[model samples]
Target: MTATAPVTPDMLTIPRKDTGGGLPNLVGMTRDAMRDALIAAGTPEKQAKMRVGQIWQWIYHWGVRDFEQMTNLAKDYRAMLAETFVVAVPEVVTRQVSEDGTRKYLVRIAGGHEVEIVYIPETDRGTLCVSSQVGCTLTCSFCHTGTQKLVRNLTAAEIIGQVMVARDDLGEWPEPGTRTEADRTRLLSNIVLMGMGEPLYNFESVRDAMKIAMDPHGIQLSRRRITLSTSGVVPEIARTAEEIGCQLAISFHATTDEVRDKLVPINKRWPLADLLDALRSYPKVSNSERITFEYVMLDGVNDSDEDAHRLVKLIDGIPAKINLIPFNEWPGAPYKRSSNNRIRKFADIVHNAGYSSPVRRPRGEDIMAACGQLKSETERGRKSKAQIAAETGT
Candidate 1:
């Protein structure tokens, strides 16, 4: 699609060059779909389910990418399966690690498009931030990724492949036929779909990929551990709860429609009223399972005391928490992060009003891997020698 054309997630064309040609990649298929694929590939119908289970464990549980590693299967059957299907994930093009131990991966996918995923290492839990699209459609003014035009929605394989790629980097997968309960709390503990795109816009693939994540036989993360952040895709809010059932986070940068229109442009499509209405009824939200309101602290913009109070009133009955993110600046960003005192005051207002308001300490700022700072290299325009000289003076 051209840069200016309106992006429809469902209709976007995916580059088939990475689909392993005629051989299907089984990385992102749901259990039932994988079973169906196995049967279609000439596995006896009666044995398809068992084969899927065995392969699922080998691929996900053990992180084995080779057919030769499937030692439990009959030799010829393993050969047949290998010839019929392949397992794959996004290819990591580059890895950047910040001083704070945050790793940013620039991964190349189909059509040579790239996206960034981040691993934030924390004392208690390591969170892997995953991307759902090649580039983002939502033009949230403060976001660097939003500065890039829409490319295409990631396929289910691309979505879950992100998780697999991170796991491979961390060496978190178990040996074959072995799993330990303690491995659940290993370095890559949580997943936040807050990396590079509006996840709700890519609903089906995101849902299916998350299913593979939460599957008992595979990566096996708890639904509570996976959080999907959206910039208010109202129609799919409830569907996210119904299908994926993970934690929900809203990219809510403003309390009023007037200001929000200039910040998160999607608010123009689904305004605060409609978005809040949907959040109030999100089937999975509860006291223990609070929805996160990701409010980026933009100085002199949406960080006023009144805005925080208004935010509290706006989310009145909903089980929610306010995540106060300091704006992670990028080149040509128009706004500044709110001052520490300003953020503290905002957090106080929300906390006094009975919601958890945590100021998120910005991570990976040195590598530009912090919140709202992820954008793939493919999004940049080519530079002429004059432009390069002007930029670098070399």
Candidate 2:
């Protein structure tokens, strides 16, 4: 029997969020479509396989931002590929440098849609947190990006391009003299899908980008090094583990339904109990590779000692680590960051319960580069007339 058509819109439109533009070139197509395009361009089955391999390498591994830089391929073949395919990159509209060395890039998608990607440099490693969508569907109250409505899923090219841009800024590209395996691995040490948007919601594109990212001959990053964070998309959780096989982190900011439902709105759809059950059944998860539960402490909200004890009970048997994130406040945010004493007390409760709960240090709050603080910088200039009228009471 013929299958039903995929539930996708024909014209790719940018989401109507406060920031960003429409992304036409990024919408539609799958892995099969990409492969067919290569085959139709006079590439034999064997050579097509080889060519796809090379394209993935150039697109991912070396982080080549331009198609013309793919010098390994012949000139004619490059022209043919260029005519048919697009190696689209999000246009970097603005860059902000934090006092603490965190850099946030405001990338303009097609049609003026924009999203934020953050580069956090450490003494030993540099982590690039990339966004997978224009805006987020989940309205997690504490998260800045959650305030915007869902625009659309980011295409594979856009998702991978964030890393390429970071490599450009960091000067971390692999040189001809330093072409060893160790050298490449150390360049972009870690990738986290925690910047903006829900990754599981855009599963296919995220998965495809990750496949290229983790390919040994391509980006060459290990699956263990890449972590895909979800705001508890329960149904897609198992599939993510089985298909992508990467580290999983859940944006589990609360310990109970009462608090979680208010913070993470999707918690209403997939409640804490259901989310925990799904985590228990996650494929290939083990003690060594424990699932990460991210709990952002909000004052007078979910930062109580009782909440911590309940959190430990909720994941009693699961192999997990709790990341205690002190809430990073943004302008107009409805909540306040829990005090140091409250955060430490909450962590103490979880740690005493035989779980590894680490209090995550706030990294880039000064420049809006911390966890759950990413929003396009361009949004500051584009205030709607309605908003202006409301502000002035006109």
Q: Clashing residue pairs, candidate 1? A: none
The most accurate candidate by TM-score is: 1
| Candidate 2 weakest ten by summed lDDT | 1-10
Q: Candidate 1, 385: how far from true, in Å?
A: 9.9
Candidate 1 per-residue lDDT over residues 1-394, each given as its tens digit: 0111221211222233354655788889989999999888899998888888899999888889888899989999989988888888888777777767777888878777889999888878889999998778888889888867788999999989999988877778887766477444577889999988889889999999999999887888899999999999999999999999999999998999999999999899999999999999999988999999999999999999999989988999999999999999887788999999999999999999998999999888888899999987765554355653443234
| Candidate 1 residue 42 C-alpha distance from true site, Å | 0.8
lDDT of 1 at 42: 91
In order, candidate lDDTs are 0.86, 0.77
Model 1 has an lDDT value of 0.86
